[model samples]
Target: MARVLYLGGLGRSGTTLVERLLGELPSVCALGEVVHLWQRDILDDERCGCGARFSACTFWKRVGEQAFNGWGNVDVLRVHALRDLVERTRHIPRLAAGHMPMDEVREYAGFYAKVYNAAAEVSGADVVVDSSKHSALAHVLRWASDVDLRVVHVVRDARGVAYSWTKTVTRPETDGAEEMTRYSPGRSALLWNAHNAAFGLLGRRGVAVRRVRYEEFLTDPRAALIRLADFAGLTLVPDDLNFLRPDHADLGVGHSAAGNPMRFTVGRLPLRRDDAWVAKLPPRQRRMVSAMCGPMLRAYGYPVFTEEA
Candidate 1:
């Protein structure tokens, strides 16, 4: 059985960083957001973390051959269409309610099973880190008997996430091509609450879940990794904290289809909280975001107060 550590949460919640850190372990194979594989990496030929085009990566090429007989055999458009229907957040509640048609669920699970199984076979790692950031997909995988699924639900402060989304998006993999992710403060807040709420619902339904707050992890990475390592069923190096020392994370070749451009980042990684939004975001926008996120913010231990007193 493939042990899949699925990262579930909204974007800009530090899932990429957490996935990269765990991917450094010998027993773990980090595949960035396989959800985007069909369109971003395979169809668009995006750069993999190994600095090669997706189709040019030897490991992924092997996975393609192993998973679907060959990369050419996979129909990108068809798979994407099915995925958009099955993995959309709007479909999550129904999927959980067992209202999703069995055929759709089967199709979704069968395709992903091949992907995850192929990844484990090609990488020779029992555990695969998939930072897909989709609560709906995570719920779908819970029913896949072929996979032993564990979830790491990452939550960041809504204000921090809202600010991150507003910043210019850049992908190191694409050089200067602008990443098109931008959301207004109000939209970001509403999505953050909904995303977090979905994951919470999953946990209540008795999924094997571990909640990791971005702020808490940054403050004490060693402790966070220890808990995560246990949940994902991996042993850590005695001095795992050394991974974060010198303000950089050592990275390896990862063939993630969709993720932050930082996936192309190698060598030492600086660790710091981006709280610039507190000082730079307009007071009115901050107040609006706080109001939108209101009770949910407090539920996650974020203060409802976004403006400086």
Candidate 2:
């Protein structure tokens, strides 16, 4: 079986950073967001973490060959259609309840299994990290018996997540000036609650799941990395974590298929909590986000009422 560490969470919850750090492990291959592989990589030919276009990246080229003969052999449209059919927030209930159409779920998850298995084979890694961060896809993977799936549920303060969606970040993976999709504070808050709740259901279903909060992870990344490594069934000696420091990490070039522009970052990257929302987010929006994410915010140890609010 192909060991997979599936990072599940809402966007801007710091999954990309977690994925990047884990990718540095000797036996792990981090594939940014395979859910976007068909559209963003295969069709758009976006930039990979290695700074090469997906079509030109030797690693992915080999992955394509290993997974399906070659990228040319993939039916991007068919995969996209399958994704649309089963991978959505609305389908999470059925997927979690195990009431899903097994045939469709298996078909969708088979593509992922192929990619993950191929990634592991091509990278010579024992485990593959997929920071797709979608609860739906993680649930759908349950039908893929070939994949040994482990879930890392990354969570951030709902307020911070809401604030992140309010900002305009450019997508550097494309040639043209394109911006990442933005969502309202309310929408982000609701999503934070829903996505986290959905992943929680995985734990109930007996899937191996670990929840890592962004705040705690950044505060003591060394310890966090060690725990994460152990969860993914890898060992990390002290020397293996030499790349990490108290305040930054020494990152190397990765070949993630899709994710935050930070996926393309290399060298020394600072590690700091993004608390801009505590002060910059309008007071009214902060209150609304807190109210909307009330139970989950508390569930994740975030204060429902803050001094800033």
| Stretches of model 1 off by over 4 angstroms after superposition | 239-241, 307-309
Clashes of 2: 0
**Per-residue lDDT of 148-257 in model 1, one digit per residue for the tens?**
88899999988888888899877766766856589988899889988899999888777898989999988877678888988988777776546666455666556676
> Candidate 2 at 132: error in angstroms?
0.4
TM-score of each: 0.95, 0.98
* Candidate 2 ranges beyond 4 A from true positions: none
Error of 1 at 114 (Å): 1.1
Listing every candidate in turn, what is its Cα RMSD in Å to the true structure after a full C-alpha superposition?
1.7, 0.9
lDDT of 2 by residue, 92-111 (tens): 88998878788989999999
Cα lDDT for residue 30, candidate 2: 98
What's model 2's overall lDDT? 0.93
